[model samples]
Target: MSGDPVAGVTAKTFGQLPDGREVELYLLVNANGLEMTVMSYGGTIVSLKVPDAQGNAEDVVLGFDSLEDYLSPAYRSANPYFGAIIGRYGNRIAGGQFEIDGTAYQVPTNDGENSLHGGDRGFDQRLWQVSAVDAKDGVGVVLSLVSEDGDQGYPGQLETQVRYTLTNDNALDIRYQATTNETTPINLTQHSYFNLEGEGGVEGQSGILDHILTLNAEAFTPVDEGLIPTGEIRSVEGTAFDFREPTPVGSRIDGDDQQLQRGKGYDHNFVLADNASDAKNGSDAEGLVLAARVEAPQSGRIMEVYTTEPGVQFYSGNFLDGSLVGKAGQPYEHRSGLALETQHFPDSPNQPDFPSTLLSAGETYKSHTRYEFSTR
Candidate 1:
């Protein structure tokens, strides 16, 4: 626990689970007055406030105000993932099955016929043990979890730690660390739906269609009808998937392309060009590269994503309907927010050509992603 009196972190009781487990909410404030609220349940980021061009701070992430809403049947039925931490495997695995060293393993299939985001009960639903940490550059919270062998049908006793640091430079840095007693496949990522225009959006207009996005990638992995990667890394040239330059998110979203039709919008994994080679070459220092950049003209808020991962999952909230009410009682309409999840390629376990996600016994897995906020 952080005992520093001047530590920019505070905690309060968010709510209680059905099993009487208490969930704690930690507020991390940086020197620049940026605030981030995170709860112990699901290691979720409930709210993140950043200043716009006019120096007005507003919540930019979509989430519920209380833990009850997150536990509600309506919310569970939708399972939009919100701002939780996805783990074990961040994306879909074909048929909910994979092999490890000639041994076949079967996991729960929660998303149609494929296993999505670590089966039915993923790390997003786990109550993590959290503690405040006073870092040299900022204040933060560390959430830890222990997944016993066979949990979620994985073959390992995995111990994981995620640290959320709010730095003075107006950056939210997420660091993930994990270790396993047995060889297992692991992919972890933070799923935060960000609407730089602020939750519902500026004025009465909703949706992130106007947000300009740029991805530092030239290709993306196409998906099948079930949204699972087809093990092909195709070029994004002359396609709607091209975001090499700053382009409005909705400019070509509805274009007459098969990939666009399959995803309903933009829901695909982009192969990060900058980090791919460095990752393969084991160049740790040069591994962190700019993955994506987003700007909201309405609020003049810009966010840049840098990561050590080899890929980023760009989701335009294609499935968000007005069914779930979020912070300030606002309906989460379609395309209201977007997520740039820094992670390994989806279905890597089944894609023989993709980078391996296997973490051997006594080996450590570490990944870092930083979201730096600023105004133009």
Candidate 2:
């Protein structure tokens, strides 16, 4: 919280949504003159303000005003992933069915006909408890929540905690920790669409198509039309999936590709780079490590992701058809949104070969992902 003062800027308990639910919003200000507002509702990030070359700040993440914006489907509230804490299960499940311990269980479908992000009622849509706020640590906020047994067809009374720190180095560090009383699968990540150019991400968007993206990966998991992984790790060398070089996102977007047609764009999961060369860092480096980078040429804004997970899903907003009006009345057209989700591969629970996302009792589930921002 910066005391420097801006008109209409103050930190206080802004309460009660349309559902009569009480929520707490924590406003965090970083050292480099950046600011953000996070709320306990879905543990969501309401606003993220970062400065441009001219030192003018702009809100780069998409969000809605009043509770109406959230309740409306147009606001993508059902997704609950608009800067919220995703968990228990982060991706989809085939027909909402999977087998564990030789027993198969069915989950309800939330996205079209597939079970997306936890389920119809996932962590994203619920209000989380604001457990702690440590201003001394440069505005670190802790949020906690408990998932009742059988919630979303997942078994167990799961306890989860998320810590977000807006650091002095112009970075936002997000940490996730969880424990389950029964044998259940869990995967959590943050969904924040960033437009360094601010407002509309394309056209006048600060980042150019030439923005360099380096994914330390040799292969990526292919997907079906519904956007579920097909359990195949195909080489990226000769495909649009290849980012070994700093190629523009649109360079290979027009190529004839079935996966592209299924997703309407790039939505596949890339296998993470293995850091086994450093065995010591291998275990604790359990999450995705330095998985990918998205750089903006004009603003010199660079986003480097570090996680303990094994895959990073790069989605090019294929479904955003300009039907939704974004901030400043800009239409959120196709490819305007990008979600770099770091986690275990999608449908991990169902796929035996994929990394195990299950957390047995007594096994602590922990993952840390940092989206550090800096200039070139």
Candidate 3:
């Protein structure tokens, strides 16, 4: 049973993997009636229920109802990293290859010629261990996992932990921390497709294409045909990529811009103007810079993204295709939802000009991101 809404953590066995390993689900609810359910498998947020303008709560994140669906071959085969924690690298690495300390390494080439979201089997597929739980400021669960040396062709053993905290202020705070035994590349992020219209999953139930979105970026990293950064940071002045002001996502999504055509939609990363270097330099608490703000007029739900990362990837869910069914047997259609992934610029390993994602021995990698929900 849920305790006082102020802060609490509840756990139960969710399901089992093919190998018979057991997985657990933790429910964290805050004072404002915001509830988040996370699972040990992939450290995923299976559901996030937030109150809307009328004070009615609904799940906003796209996911399934049963753990079996998540473990099924069909679900696994078609997963778009829905509600999972992405790791090792959150975005693409050109040609599935990179050089670290003069050593070349090959990663999983799951995305055309590039490696995406940590390769063929990433942290999203791993079973993380719950290390601690606290319900002070809010209900917080700390999930830890250690990626073995050379796992998916990366270097060193990376010991990482992600803390999911549901705050009384209706903020879902995700804090990432990691350390490696040797020099390696590390980028972690949450991959949640949110449809502020509420996770109805049925056709016409939600369409993020019309959601008003505002990104705090003056520039963006353009991509090539394969969606890999072309090593150039260009201004978004007159381009459709300009999201400096609040604009409907679909306003120019179908424009004749070459970049829009290349991505098939908005899948590019916007370079954040606010500097978060102070946080990376080991500050205990760093101010989370506003990255993006999205609002769904139909439901009157608003979500503001804050992070300490250098960039945010605004994905318009261009590939959902309606083949996969979600919670309560709801069919997920094209552009039904969207993902705002906060992280370092894509292909940072290959782009020396971008902020480095490399982590050295004895150096810790820390990142903070938050999604604050509300109603207008």
Q: Compare the candidates by lDDT and give the number of the best one.
A: 1
Candidate 3 is scored at a TM of 0.95
| Rank ordering of all candidates by lDDT, starting from the highest | 1, 3, 2
Between prediction 1 and prediction 3, the one with superior TM-score is 1
Model 1 clashing-pair count = 0
For residue 110, model 3's alpha carbon misses the true position, in angstroms, by 0.9
lDDT of 3 by residue, 1-376 (tens): 2443545788899989889999999888877667889999999889999887888788899998788888788776776888999988999999999998788999989988999999999999999998547657777899999999999999999999999999888899899999888988888999999988887743454478778999999899999999999988899999999888899999999999999999989999898888523324223446689999999878899999999888899999888888878875667888888999998888988987788888889888888999998889
Q: Pairs clashing in candidate 3?
A: none
lDDT of 1 by residue, 326-372 (tens): 89688889999999999889899998789878888867788889999
- Candidates' C-alpha lDDT: 0.90, 0.73, 0.87
Task: Give the clash count for model 3.
Answer: 0
Clashes of each: 0, 8, 0
Evaluate model 2: give its TM-score. Answer: 0.90
Which candidate leads in TM-score?
A: 1
Per-residue lDDT for 190 in model 1?
A: 96
Worst 10 residues of 3 by lDDT: 276-285
